[model samples]
Target chain A: MKRKHKRLTFVGLALLLLATAAALTLSAFEESIVFFQSPTDIVTKSVSPNKRYRLGGLVEEGSVRKKDDAVVTFRITDMANTVNVSYRGILPDLFREGQGVVTEGFFVSDVFTADEVLAKHDENYMPPEVADALKKSGKWNEMSSKMKKQGHVLGGGSQ
Target chain B: MLHRFANPTRFLRIASIAQPWIAWATILLAGTGLYLGLFNSPADYQQGESVRIMYVHVPAAWMAMFCYTSMAIAAGIGLIWKHPLADIAAKATAPVGACFTFLALFTGSLWGKPMWGTWWVWDARLTSMLVLLFLYLGYIALINAFDDPARGTKSSSILVLVGLINVPIIKFSVDWWNTLHQPASVLRMDGPSIDESMLWPLLLMALAFKTYYIWVLLVRIRAEIISNKIRILRLRQVHG
Candidate 1:
């Protein structure tokens, strides 16, 4: 009985330590999360112009412009709203108009000035956030149908 | 019902019959999955060929989470019901879970540098996953830290039950915080958000991983039981 009591105490102490550590770590991160926002989210929410964030969507058709050197500018849209993004780095090889793009940068004077740009290169792939942005803005049926026509089958999972 | 299968003789008989079938299924499914992933699947529109990494990465991530979950559940049974088999099963699962977690992180990093422009980020999702790997290592270490095997098992099982708090956090990390990691389309609402062509390979790989876990787990448990038997026999001979 004495040995069993000691084991119980040890278990309790371990639980206490784990709970403390988890609580501290979780609270520490509560203030420092970078959210991936959609174009519609940018338009509706007042994001600080200087704070860095990730913005994802399909590049608007015919909106990509190659400027001097490697710098380029484009408009990304969730079909409900669009945001302008400018980047100076060499774009990922897959960056193209009418494709899913996720950019990490800051807003300067309402323009998303991206430092990095990532494209969904799969001929059939759509980034989930971009898809959600379109769906939440109620343009999914129209756009998703068009995407489906491109031979992109919706992935299998529980609805 | 639990006690009925607690006998090692019964477990060995059942596992012997189940082993070959599970092993072959793993080969068949994983082989098919590799072929389709490497050849049949279309190059991603954006990431192009690099997206094929998901055939391995996503499944590994799933197995890492799956193994930890089953271990925790087993550990809980050991704690509450004092089931020796439960603890032994949990012990056997640790290294396997750790390997899967490591694969997830390694493959994810390889996928990341080309896709995210960086091999790693201190983002919530990535950091939480790294923590999970550490937790697995810690569990394995703690289990062996003690001289007495029972003490080691008891303490580690307690640690495991406590470590389980991380699972939900890992699953929701992307959603709860802003992250470079893509949000889950495969396990989320309104069905899979990704295309079906990619989804099939991912699912098959997941099944293959699960089968691989069971095959290895049975072998590990059998070895553990046999080692224990040898230890007991040696002790009896010495005392007599």
Candidate 2:
């Protein structure tokens, strides 16, 4: 009986140790967690200029400006506000004016510098985090109508 | 629960009756899910045709974690109560879980090249998911390493419980780690951020994958129970 008790206690302790270690590792990475902020939040919060974060909204129509080489400048808008973004890379084929886009980077003065950008390839798509941010901003209803019309605007092609 | 279901005759009787329905559901749901995900859903405006990968990748990823979690819970029951059925359940689940994890990684990589511009990255979520796959492989190997089935089950049960720690880590890795993977938007405290048009399909796919896992797991567990019975019966016939 004593031996059985000892074994049970050992196993219990081992499980506890593993759980604690994993929780610690998870919390340590918290600073790296990036949450999506709308153009309005970016404007109002005066978010730290260099801190890495995400900006998600529709690309303002007629705001895309292709610069020399791969460089491009555009504006992201949540209808409440807009932020300018400059990116230098091969843009995804789906990237266009007036489409949902999420970019990870931070603000530098008036320009929002993007290190990476996400472009959905389908009509029924949204980045899980970006969606949360939009719902929090009370702009999800506005986006839903736009998503329904996406098929009509994108040529109604399956590909 | 394990003791009541441990007897192979009892298990066989229950599983045999359920097997055909489980098989049919698996077939039906998988077909419907594939049709809707592939043919009906509209192509992403930005991703073009590649967005079709999401339907498969997301479902597979979800199953990978869900399978491991079920295995771990079975292991815990086995260890705490020495329940025979729990060990068998854990044994049956490991390979299936590993396969799902492998599929998730495979599909994620295929999707990543065009989207992230790289086939592999040390992004928190991706790396953690890879670790989960490795953990599943490790459990499978540990269980089969020994000649003695009881010894193998006992040792591997411990491993499964230890590996359970990784599940939460995987779920929160995107939130905690500064990695390329995006944070959670659909499962959140405030509410889902995605539009209903996109959210509904993803949710449907998620449910379809979950239901399919139960169907597959039940089938696999029944097979294991029958094999165990055959081994015991053969021993008795030879000795008699």
Candidate 3:
């Protein structure tokens, strides 16, 4: 082979090896790499209560209940299953009913007792006027249903 | 055909002509993009004014990945074909890519504080992007570590090629894992979810960033060529 062809083979071989190594490493750490588990994932896996993990899903509409001293309780749902979460302290500015969220804690009895709660916003972005117009035209519900059909993974998840 | 522009004199001539046009394009695109982003575009229904940060943050993030990919490709060409200009091009791209990565992280943090309620997280998307920033920095540091410039170039080119793996990982992190960061809005199988008004500023800003990279790369490559000449002259004088 020419010197250039020889160098090409070497680089190509190196890249192939590196890719294989990365694939193996990422697969090995797949479980840990997932930042949060959806309510459905939790239900199907029946995860142990002894371990702490992040629970993520949409905050179910009309499920938020504020208690005294900055404690709030809500239900996180994947549209297929729901998990009750109780969080203390302040919620993020983006936290709201019908919005995506992730709470970090372990299950206390049946409820998820969260120490850290984060809002996970979706990719959709539209002006307030457009949103209002969509609502007025009754297209908002259609769009929302379309999103639901796509899956309630929030930011695309392993599920 | 690949080495048609391998001659430094010919390359310099072309770069000199293209540089001013790229510089002006950057200024014009950036000015219009800022205007549209800050004023013309309406506030997001949910994020409100904070959504404007996307114009800067998203473009910077795109440019960061773009630069790294381009750098890796140039480095690979330099390694396989022994192209001096390719090596210079890869070297010139490093600091610019690093700056874009830093801007993405900084703007992301600012945006995150109000939206996500945190400055940072260890989520897969965010973590992989952070790793990209480190890879750029590591490549820069490695290239400068050796006294012998040729050795530095060879080693750093290998490093750049190896680091190319992170680009794909970063892009798919949100999809492969549950991340706090949202998935792609623009470069998705489905068309961009963003409204047309919001998307215009984003595209303009991304174009502006691309032109800025080209303008800077040309200047850096010219400087590198001159410096190489100076080094050669000094070595010849001393040896003679």
Question: Which candidate tops TM-score?
Answer: 3
What are the lDDT scores of the predictions, listed in order?
Answer: 0.79, 0.72, 0.92
Highest DockQ: which candidate?
3
lDDT of 3 at B166: 93
Give the TM-score ranking, best first.
Answer: 3, 1, 2
Q: A1-159, model 3: which lDDT tens digit per residue?
A: 399999999999999999999989998998889888889888888778889989999999999999987899999998889999999988999999998898999998889999999998988899999999999999988987777666534656635
Task: Provide the global lDDT of candidate 2 against the true structure.
Answer: 0.72
Measured against the true two-chain complex, the DockQ scores of the candidates, in the order shown, are: 0.20, 0.14, 0.80
After superposition, which runs of candidate 1 have C-alpha atoms over 4 Å from their true positions?
A: A1-28, A35-63, A75-85, A94-114, A118-159
- What is candidate 3's TM-score for chain A? 0.89
Q: Could you tell which candidate, 2 or 3, scores higher by lDDT?
A: 3
lDDT of 1 at B104: 98
Q: Any runs in candidate 3 off by more than 4 Å, and if so which? A: A47-50
Docking class of 1: incorrect
Model 2: per-residue Cα lDDT over A18-63, one tens digit each: 8888677656654343335557667887678868867766688899
